[model samples]
Target chain A: MPYRFLEDVAIADVAFEAEGRTLPEVFEASALALTEVMVDLDGLSPVLSREITLTAEDLETLLFRWLAELIYLKDSACLLFCRFQIAIREGTEWELQATVWGEGIDYGKLPLKLDVKAVTYHLFVIEQIPAGWRARVVLDI
Target chain B: MEAKKIAEGIWEVPRTAKEGMLVPARIYATDKLFKEMDQGVFEQVTNVACLPGIQKYAICMPDGHWGYGFPIGGVAAMDTKTGVISPGGIGFDINCGMRLIRTNLIEAEVKPKLRDLIDRLFHAVPCGVGTKGFLKLKEDEFREIMVQGAQGIIRRGYGWPEDAERMEDAGRIPGADPAKVSPKATSRGIHQLGTLGSGNHYLEIQVVYPGNVYDADAAKAMGIDRDFQVVVMFHCGSRGFGHQVGTDYLDLFGPAMKRYGITIRDRELACAPFASPEGQDYFKAMVCAANSAFANRQMVTHRIREVFSDVFKRDARDLGLDIVYDVTHNIAKIERYQVNGEEKELLVHRKGATRSFPPGHPELAERYRATGQPVIIGGSMETGSYLLIGTAKAMEESFGSTCHGSGRTMSRTAAKKKVHGRDLLQRMEQKGIYVRAASFAGVAEEAGMAYKDISDVVEAVETLGISKKVVRLQPIGNIKG
Candidate 1:
């Protein structure tokens, strides 16, 4: 696993730390952590797909929008994803393009966990270390 | 790091505690609760005090805990002319609140049907993640709901005409401009009007035993005269729509802050001047979300009435399922308050806090004018909830605000590790509390052990005379999202 749940990071909400050797890998890991909070990935199959393209001024804002988009899709379309192919271009501006795969929720079929309300900015950070890149996220549950 | 004890249940941190603080930060809690609060709350409350145009103090209720930007159970009143409006202070779930419905049915009548009732309600009220509402609204109709709120549903025969009166702001606030709302928010919320979103949102059937009635006169006034009286309480908000609005504004405010030349310790506390175009736009959009929440709860109320009527074979009106009161815990409203003995209009932002307007306030309906606004405090599923009333002291001291719920003491992961979902269900069943949840794992996350004691949280406010207790309600059946 590329990510781990951070216990005690938030008392009422869920928090996770994701790490990868690159920006795209880190973004994918963060998305997986968020999805895992809602349902067990072992039971989820990627039967459907969605392509998301987002642009932001900075990597932090871009990460925030990326996770928030997944939450939006979950509520608006009742979809959940377990697989992602992400690409990130970083410079004065940042751009992200991802092809995500998921399936429509069947409450009886999937073992659901919690509802991720929104991606919050409290103690939200994305940083680069000598090893690679790491991101910390707190989701309002 | 130490705070000075200014009064009983009140602690103050002077402006010197932080470099940019404009006013002192005040926290209302018993000594025990103060000790239990996380260090983050102290930092966040003081961070709020540093915002420009903050008047008096940045305040936190006994239930205060670490949250994004403003601490949960936080309150701050900003100057209208000079202060700024931040979505962080109002919370992501705009108008996330509690609604109490009174019933003539007694505990005995509900006991036999408890399991059936909760199961029916669990299905009737669409809940859990990725849940869509029964109503598939058109864009124009959805926009109308953003403006009319519960009144729109009532007009469509989903609710009684009197239901609107019992809700705060009469279930609708003025200046809700649908044009201010974004298409993304509209798409996210269009189908969620009648849903009970997951995470700490629940609908419970409670019994008010005679021993629990503290203020007989006040309880009777609110229609809780019978021993073992039954009532329904549900907590929810604007669902995805409100969250998208918060996200949208927060994104916009990031740039707006730079344009206005304002800087803050945390990026989550992004804000803009109240009278600025960006600020006004977000406020108007927020009102739409608030109204959407009102309409969402109204739709749920309709379902509750239908379920009760179906189970009892009686008309809903005859069953006496009247609304006791509905109050918003997450919101920002422009209200008049006395600051330094001078009457001033201020924008009061309450995040994870309830408004407790006292007796004879012009904002309340005539029916409740003499009794003060009813304050509904929801406890954990394993414990009980409380019915209280606003106090004049709340107006004088805490901007007419009180704690929202039993604040969390343990993390979700810890709670799940400590108790199995299946075991929790059986334990609650043995205790006479039947719970029907969308997911068993979700239930474990909300175990009573994860939170502070409800009575203690209520005690702190009652001790301060911020709100007065009317009755206590023990849960018998519960439905969780």
Candidate 2:
């Protein structure tokens, strides 16, 4: 697993740390962690695809917006994604473009876990660790 | 930060406790309660005191716990002119609250049908994570809900018009500019108007405990006349609409903070000056989310009434099912308060705390004017809940705010590790509290042991006269998402 859950951080919310060699790789792992919090991603099939584009003034904000956009898709479209293909670029501004793949939620077939309210910036950090890029995200569940 | 006992059931962290603090941070708690609290609350409360234009003190209720920026059960009033508005202080679940409904039927009469009633309710109200609500509203119709709130639902024939007056702010806070709400928020809100979202959100059937009425006149006014009288209570918020609003603004305010020359200790505390354009826009959008929650709860109440009427084979009106009150604990509102004996308008942010207006307050309904606004505090499922009334002390000391519920003492993961859902279900069943949950793991996450003892927290407030106890209710059936 590229991501691990953080325990005892929040009374009511969930948190996780995702790591990879590149920004896009870490972003994908973070997205996976988010979906896994909602449902059993291993049993899910990426049968549908949705493209998302987000822009922010900084990399940290970009990551927050990206996760928030995924949550928005889950609530608005009732989609549960398992795969993420993401690209990140920084010049004068920060931008994230991603192709997220998931299928419509079939409650009878999928065992839903918890409803994540939103992403929180509490103790949120993204940095290039010695090995790769690492990000810590706390989700309000 | 160190706390000094200032009064019985009150502790104060002086301004000298932290740097940049404008005022002291006060916590309402007994000695034992204070010791039981997590240490993070001290830091969070002090951080809240550092906010610009913070009036009097940053207040934390007895049930306070560590939260993102402001501790859960935090309350602060900011000056409208120089103060700032923070989405963190308002919380992610905008207008998340509790609503009580009283039915004429007694517990003895409904005991045999409890399972059936819960089943019907669970089906009538779609629940669980990412579930779509029954209301298939068009885009314009949904926008109307964002603006009109509970009244909009009533206008659509989903609720009784009389129920509107019993709601806090008459179920609609004015100045809701729907256009300010983002397209993402609207999209998420369109299908989630009536859903009971998961994670500690629930609908419970409760009975008035015998001899539990502390104020007979007040309880009677709320339709709690006799022992064993049945009532329904549900906890939820603006659903996806509110979450999206908080998300969008956190992003907007992050950049806007630099332009306003504000610095925050935490990123989640990103805010803008209340009078700034960004602040005004976020406030308008927040109102829309708050209104959406009102509509959401009203729709759920409508469904509950329908389910009750269907199961009991009686007219809904004949059942005497009426709203007692709906109170939002998580919200920011502009209200006039007496500051230093001078009436001034301030923006009050109450996160994990409920507004408890005192007796004879003009904002209360006529029936409750002499009594006070009903403050509903929801305990964990295994524990009973309480109905309390506001006090003058709360108005004078804490901006008319009181604890919302028994704040969690255990993390969700820790709670899950401590209790198994199947075993919890059996335990509740043995205690005559039937529970139907969408997921077992979710159930474990909300184990009763995860929270502080509600009675202790309630006693702290009652002892301080912040809020007075009215009645106690024990749950008989519960539906969790």
The candidate maximizing DockQ is 2
Question: Model 1: per-residue lDDT, tens digit, B1-481?
Answer: 6798999999999999999999999999999999998888999999999998899999999988888899999999999999999999998999999999999999999999988889899999999987888887899999999999989988988999889999999999998999999899999889988899898999999999879999999999899999999999999999999999999999899989999999999888999999999999999999999999999999999999999999999999999999999999999999999999999999999999999999999999988999999999999889899999999999999998998989888888889999988899999999999999988889998999998899999999999999999999999999888
DockQ-derived CAPRI band for the predicted complex in model 1: medium
**What's model 2's lDDT at B17?**
89
Q: TM-scores of all models?
A: 0.99, 0.99
The CA lDDT of each predicted structure is 0.93, 0.92
True-contact fraction per candidate equals 0.64, 0.79
Candidate 1 C-alpha RMSD relative to the actual structure:
0.9
TM-score attained by chain A of model 2: 0.97
| lDDT, residue A30, model 1 | 97
lDDT of 2 at B343: 88
- Put down candidate 2 lDDT per residue, B158-200, tens digits, no spaces: 9987999899999999999988988989998899878899998
Cα miss at A105, model 2 (Å)? 1.1
TM-score of chain B of each: 0.99, 0.99
lDDT of each residue in A56-110, candidate 2, tens digit only: 8888988898889889988988988998889888979998888989898888898
